[model samples]
Target: MARVPAGADLELDVQLEGVAEGVLVTASVVAPLAGDCARCLEPFTSVMQVRFQELFAPESAEPADADEQDAVESYPLDGSGQLDLEPALRDALVLELPLSPLCEDDCKGLCPECGVRLADAEPGHEHEQRGAMWAALKNYRAAGPEGSSAGEEAVPDGKAGPERTTDRTDTAPGQAGT
Candidate 1:
């Protein structure tokens, strides 16, 4: 989630050259960024710098070749001969921004159970592993009444107990035993 802070001033060094087909803009940018660490969720501040070159061509120009069409994105120039640099800056900075912004290269993050920072916790800090069935039963029992212990056998709504067995075989309407 790292991004440039609002109202932050950027350092832009650009050179606009008039080429045969269009204006070739070579620029170097430095932006101030602030965000939370993706691993440990801690606030951090950083600075990013990037250098890029792009061509601003007239709106009526066509792609020279198929390879050039895919490789170069020609930013269209307006008919009045004025161009805005916002779109170019936006594209360059957005592509250069890191997807996973880390406070440190080797951040250990946090403990899964106690929610403690892993780096601050003891080396052997861990929780007892419970079985899947045991964990589910424990959660289910906890959601019920406080007095309802696992040792007790509770019946269903219409009175089903040891007498109501599910092993009954289907019999004909008139016959009893085969």
Candidate 2:
């Protein structure tokens, strides 16, 4: 039916028999499914055969017991004793449909970094490693305020520069421990 999400075409080969309380409908449903593979995004098609048997109770009939009512699952027939098979067929086929259809058993899928399909990629396909962008900020902090080289004092002969202060008492205004 058109309700099938993956564009599947359904055909039902059905037989009906009258029972004591209802009509028993038996069918072999054949559906041709077409959709993309979940992992590889490749298109695929397959035939699915589902065997279904459901009891459609007459509209005037009532359950003999509460327990029987709870245990037995049956669809209701129309006032004229005609069964609408759409709901039963829809539920049966949908439940049998695959949650994630795959083109192959071992699909590698697409690369997260490059979006290239892994199956078609080279033997050692890889991207260059990128350093963190914040690393430059850390290097700048190590350099003095006047733009000295990292890890080296601004003054010559390894002496601490005027910008480099060891004394905590000489803190900048509004800073703690002044």
Candidate 3:
């Protein structure tokens, strides 16, 4: 047995049986690994354990039919009883990593105005002014038609432009009310 990373551990027990020309090996592994939080980008750790059954065929064995031998690996057992587990452990750690990690469910993230982490902000602190485009549109409307009231002008027939009229209500310089 090989030591897994401190974050995760691995435990494997194997039993081999001879079934005709092939050998069957059943094993299990338990381990831990570390991951980064997706939202706050903080480090987090988790544990995992998995069991698998695999069959090993002799180097001399050959399938008589065209059908493929599925889920079987052919290995020539070395003189030493030990089988290197690096590949299996690598796969286990990779599989255990989460698709997405988060330090908290609702991470406030950094404020757009000051780049301050919203998670640490003082309560009831108003966020800075952000909507400038809307203010500009309101100002445009308030300054309508060269700053004159609609009823006092004739609206220039089909021209669709502000009408200049000699009517006293419109011609009076101070009568314009926005």
Candidate 4:
């Protein structure tokens, strides 16, 4: 509860049954929770009901068997034979709390590029295309087949103008004549 900044309002409906070695406690908690939406950062509130049963073993009681101890989870009673409910209540509520709360099921959230809320923005709202890493190629195409700039030479029929080779005579077997 301390970790959750907006602490929940807890209402517990509890029942206790005494056994030979321990007390069985059944609790249903109605908690009102408030937090900000994970996506759109909008504030939201909700009510969560969690029901759980746990065994509070007496301080003098030992496990009946290793398997029984391993299978069942039990909280230890205090030296005065009083059961502490805070830890149990904390566990039940915290487990049910939403990790990422949302104002609505499908929140569009904010635009990464402009930081504008997508929910409030006009439908089909978009910014002009900002060029990407290959933006120069786009501009090159926009400048026509002549070239991106007037100083540059025109490409020859969509092919490299001429074969510029070094003194090396190496060629793949099939590519020798081609």
Candidate 5:
């Protein structure tokens, strides 16, 4: 959830060196990041510093070896050997962004029941939670007889049940009527 905003200005300190194949660019970037916290979901801003090195080479001369290929990039520099540094800067900065960003290391996040920001809540904040087995009992009052067969007594949960029938002629086989 963390990312750098588009159109944000980046501060760059760069060193250009002439290598055998191309111009090597070594740069350190300071970027402004804006993102939502993964836990508390609060908007926050932070600064990230990244260091990257890349070779801006002509597109015609492709690196032959896999290892060498990674060390050098085939970026088409302009006729004057001018470098386009945005892609290299983006790649380096994105790798350093935290996947699960938090407002703080000790952020408590939102309460499960009330959804209030737990960090802002009073000390020892909690709700009256029942155990799973007992928690299911609360639905009995509203659990109407959705699948109860005819002639069997409906569960007594302070709600109305079907009218009782005296005849057992229509009852399914082996099912006793009450």
Candidate 6:
């Protein structure tokens, strides 16, 4: 077992089959990692297990095959000709980490209207009021004196007369006192 820089552990166990030209590596991996959840902004820990088989091309291949041979890697063999499995097992485990993690099944996020934390909201918490501009307009329509219309005269349908005056007052500004 070997420890990586960020506290990840790598372990490898394998049986290497050496052919006339190349070596095959089979191994298992274990990894422990930490990440922040995307939705809830909480930390989470996870363990990942991976297993893989890698074919290692030999170093003595022809010069014309160098480009294709460079694409593959050859594992170093011990004095007894057994393949070392450490490097490949570590690589596979690191690739298995989640790009984005989620902390819980239901993460109530921040409120869009008020930017408050939705998960921590009170049972009947009312929203903040910025002062209702149209409060007088609404109150005027409700609960006026009974049988009293607010000067909205009903025009008789069959009668002909001058058009109803929409302007509340015709008094000139400076002549009102006289």
Q: Quick one: best TM-score, which candidate?
A: 5
lDDT of 1 by residue, 1-178 (tens): 8898888999999999999768888999999988888888887888999898899888667455768766767788778877777789889999988788887778788888878877678887777666667898888878765545432444431255544433222234325653
Scanning candidate 2 in windows of ten residues, the lowest lDDT window is 149-158
Candidate 6: pairs in clash = none
- Candidate 6 structure quality by residue, lDDT tens digits, 4-111: 238556555666767755678777766665666566555666555678887754444534476765775555444555555656665676566566655544756556
Model 6 / residue 149 / CA error / Å: 21
lDDT of each prediction vs. the true structure? 0.78, 0.73, 0.55, 0.71, 0.76, 0.57
Cα lDDT tens digits, model 3, 1-178, are 1223554445667677777756666666666645565655556565556665555554445454335544345444343555445554465446655577454567666666766656677874455355465677778877875655663344443244434344444658666653
Candidate 2: regions farther than 4 A off: 1-8, 105-108, 111-114, 118-178
- Count of backbone collisions in candidate 1: 0
Encode model 2's per-residue lDDT on 59-126: one tens digit a residue. Answer: 55645667877776788887875679988888898888777876666878888888888888997777
Better of 4 and 5 by TM-score: 5
Which pairs of residues collide in model 5? none
Write the candidate numbers in order of decreasing lDDT. Answer: 1, 5, 2, 4, 6, 3
Which residue pairs in candidate 4 collide?
none
Per-residue error for 53 in candidate 6, Å, reads: 1.6
Better of 1 and 5 by TM-score: 5
Question: Lowest-scoring 10 consecutive residues by lDDT in candidate 3?
Answer: 1-10
Using lDDT as the yardstick, the better of models 1 and 4 is 1
